[model samples]
Target: MQSTAKAGPSHESVVTNGNGNGGAKSTPPTQRTALILYGSETGNAADLAAELASLTTRLHFRTTCQDLDSVSLRDLLKPTLIIFVVSTTGQGEFPQNARLFWRRLCSSALKAASLRKVRFVSFGLGDSSYPRYNVAHRMLCARMLQLGAGEVFERGEGNEQHPEGHSAGFREWIVGLREKIMQSFPLAEGVTPIADDVFLEPEWKLELATTDGTNGVMEGNVLPLRVANGHKSEPSSAAFSSKLDGTTGVVPNEDILPVKGAFTARLLSNKRLTAPDHFQDVRLLDLQLEEPYDYYPGAVAVVYPKNFPADVQDFIDLMKWQNFADKPLNVISTASKQLSPSPLRHLDLTHTHLTLRWLLENVLDIMSIPRRSFFASLAHFVGTATEDEAYQRERLLELANPELIDELWDYTTRPKRTILEVMMDFTMLKIPFEYVLTVLPMIKGRQFSIASGGAQRLDEGGSSMRVELLVAIADPPSPIIKYRRRYGVCTRYISSLQPGQQITIGLQPGYLDVKAEEMSVPILMIGPGTGVAPMRSMIHQRLAWARSMGLRTAGKRLEGDVLLFGCRSESADYFFKDEWHDLVEREGLTVWTAFSRPQTSTNAGVAGATDGDRTATRKQYVQDKIHEHASRVHEMLVKQNGKVYVCGSSGNMPKSVREAIADVFVECGASMAREQAEAYVDVMERDGRYKQETW
Candidate 1:
């Protein structure tokens, strides 16, 4: 049996017993139905939800996976089992894809009896370093319970920063979830669940077809080019352009473009932002767009970077696929009935002919940390003759077991080992190409806040615009075997680019939700380290507007515009120092800087001093500076109705800043209790007077 209805903003439908392939017949409904819904900003939760749906299907239940926003209250009420996989984003806020659903759920009209028949379980993906870890899923579970939904099991929290990695907690939770399901709803007679096999059944099958001259090549399709000595053909200019346009025909330079997807841009320059002797390596990159693109001050530029050539070659060597590296191949699902829905299903596979090398480099994320299932899958391919293979298979199975999670963490995550390294280490385990494709994670782009102002242009004609980015090259805490230095995939790829080199990119609207062009009141921006990127954009824009209006400070002190910036040392990492001074002089901008490490000249040598330095002047943090100017900040936020913007590390910076602001309300003789002061900040957030962009 199958049923369909418009569920969410994407207009996606919930389906049961229906394969994803068109024209495939639906299976009869099972005794019970389950719904696996997810809200994901980065697709992690969605992937988990899909996996759970497949598992439930094997258990003889009619299961459907859909985004939370797509399903209404009425739809949610029907499911006997509802599994929620959600990720928390931006200071206890729901993912953008789930915001509308969350708002509707929060409506007072939905009483306790609305979801009385529903039985639910929740799995949250979060970073434990944040103050409001797993807040989104926690809120959802609480609200559902209040609406009379029965809990199938305790809510599971998957910590990305966990010592054993998020998969450790997830694997443990799934074991418990399976037990709960079995107890709650026994399988019907004559129905048997699939065994926990080591080898994954092929969801997708590989097929090869000889290119016929009659069919014209599809746009963006990777067609094999004939080359001498059986070499692969270079990517044609048309193919490059088509890849930039993605599935959507609209060019990136158009005024209105999709918030996410691939686009093309040229590297104009890559200049070092910090001194050579500095411990941190920061680069100032300038990318030239094809044409003037309309973007707000706080917008972000997403770069779709490829794997390092060396790493890609390493993977190819390990797979022993040099012979088939350039061979044309097509992928299609083996079963007519799709076990789970996949974005890859939409691709016209008949027209696509991708090479093995291209798939490894452009399609899969080989460098990602492997989940527990990955190890278990590899064990299936291990040869049992050699003691090493036998030991490895046993060890891998143990690692997959949730009870030995710490050992798994030590072996893989703590050392920051990549999947490629793990495969190389297990010399006897040779995984099939099709299995590898099914298991590997998809490559995603890295997003950076655009640092340039909206008024700035690369050239006089404005046909091409220039945008700046500040990137800090990542260096692992300690070097691993075989690798000299560890670099973030995207940052390293960007750093390797030369002037005039073209790169594929995309644009994503800023999540700060503050519009600089619509501002009518004073703004206070707090940014530390590289967090100054978006703040710089906003400051430049405001200064440009002030210049056009001929505005200036009438007195000794500036009013309205304020920026609080923090960094390690004034000489080493003070970004745009001269620009800030110019803005203060020309546009009446107020600026405050907190240097966590200050350089002081001494007889011994020029030494770096911190807050502990007694003889030398003390170093200060931005939070401390805010505490010092409590009254002034209170006046700006409460009395003057000014907006507060924070951009920085997700760890403790955001929480510290909020605490500092709350203290201002209490210390300013307002007679407000601490709880009330905190609530005041919550009100500011809800009113859109306070915004934050943190990673």
Candidate 2:
């Protein structure tokens, strides 16, 4: 978690066409090397670049894995082959490094015929769940072609769900790239050939002795422990009052259980952000962290969330565990060999010195639905029920589908079914954590946009950074008993904290270039609802930096900042409105507010505002506003060397805005829909004109 890598060089230096000493272009020193340029937000693309670099070195190709911002267009064009591995940030925007790189690439000078010798291949990574899946890679690939770069092979595009997981797809792609590279560029002397058949699996294992007795039976891969009455809601404590169900449970004091090292922080303040009339609950969290924690303006912090104690207790009751809390048991692991070691053991069912409740919440996923194999393992239990084959088939079908299983588990069948019930149903088997892990996505941290500048200060001692975080306290509509809409894990934790309560958190380094020193740089921020966290931070940084420079926040021709903020109702959810006014009045800021719900034809409200005799219209969504200012945005990005930043939901708003921009390009003129849209976004990206951070 503690990163020691030096901060990268200035963005201008990497994108500059000519050195200050001479008007002549400064070509890179490593002419024979290949540059692996990665535009990654979550480090996956970077990891892929590192893997490729390690493999390419064996091919005698001196390679360097670089962030896109570290190299200029000259360096890119000079490389024999530049591998662009990029993932699309929110709203189809480029990742931080790629944004800067793309902006510069789109500059008139770089796009001219003077540099048409670039040869490149791209591999884009994205999830299929989103509509614009792999859109970033498509954009980069098109830009390379438009700028006269030759392609060595078909672009490699990998989805989140690839080949029963990633290993197979990754191995295949790397092998293909290796073969293509070998075929294109003859092997130099003394270069060794890599083995064609390398098994791609994590290299680690653990051995533990199995426990015996009526406590539990070590079935196939999982241990089947006994349970009382089989009701999930019955607390493990109550179930064990008369008889031992043979399982154990543990309760944690604080919400967070530090796994690795936790990032310590001081929760400066917390206030209810939403109105009392609103059904949803939200909060404005202000925290101050120590210095040397540099972050970009539009970056997200990944927070690890813990399950509620009530839910943990429910899992315990079903397992029928006891007070074996501090007892010792073997912990195992089964991760791939080439990867870094995971926090927990692999294959071992028994965890050491940890309570049953602790294991269910912090370790095992208790909410995981029973898999098909699990029912198959419990086949013997079916003997107690009716022997009708139709009944068995119905039960099997129910286990396979989550929707059906949830209905039965919540309403008709109920949590009364335990491991013993499984014995009465189908097969009895031991379930591996790996198989279980797949049932639910990793419990990831909610990424909030860093709104303040890293270079700002609060009290003389603490560094000031603004974060615009969404605190969603609404429950989802689900048929499953457990899936009932409840306050989100992190949101409720944040909402419940008192002003004086010190909260612990980690500062994930920012990716966008919103440093304190760059206060004079023009920035255009678009954030709807709570997505404005990082934008607030960036604006705050700019204000603080401007104050330090003894410069007025506004009036002078200082770098202009524009904010396009959207919400449901201006009255109920206009978050940070007063603070925004203070920023504009004290520091010369401009804000554009969009209220979609209230201003709709169905619910008209709010008066129009006038600026220099020009009256602004009633509210609309952010995407419509973006189109209205499309000409200005094009000018800002293409001419004035400004940056465009977006932060918001992972759903519709961002997607619409991107599509609107793509339509603007089509209106002007471009080849295919995908190509032109890609080119335009790529232009903004390569030149540092765009940055996006969203959940």
lDDT of each: 0.67, 0.52
lDDT score, candidate 1: 0.67
Model 1 alpha-carbon drift over 4 Å, by segment: 1-35, 50-54, 57-80, 99-119, 127-135, 142-151, 159-172, 189-193, 211-260, 343-353, 383-385, 457-459, 479-484, 516-518, 544-558, 601-616
Q: Spell out the clash pairs found in candidate 1.
A: 7-70, 8-70
Instruction: Name the weakest run of 10 consecutive residues (lDDT summed) in model 2.
Output: 14-23
TM-score of 2: 0.57
Kindly list the per-residue Cα lDDT of model 1 for residues 516-623, writing each as its tens digit: 443567888999988899999887776555555545434322356678888887778888877776666654667777778866623111121112122324588889
Score every model by TM-score.
Answer: 0.80, 0.57
Q: Over the stretch 1-695, how does candidate 2's per-residue lDDT look in tens digits?
A: 11111233211211222211111232232223467889977556765675665455445444556778878877765556668888876656677557888888777765445346666677888754344578888987887777777787788877664522322345457668877877666544553443211111112221222333123232223222222233212222222323211212222234334444345455567777889988666776666653345555555555545544545554444333333322223223332112222324221222122334445545443433333323432231222234564466456546533234354444323333333234333332222222223222223344565545534434445544434344555433444335233334455445545444434455555556555544545777888888777677777666656666776634432346777788887678877777765655554566777777653343222222101123234657988766777766555554556777777675566667667666655544434466766687767766556666555
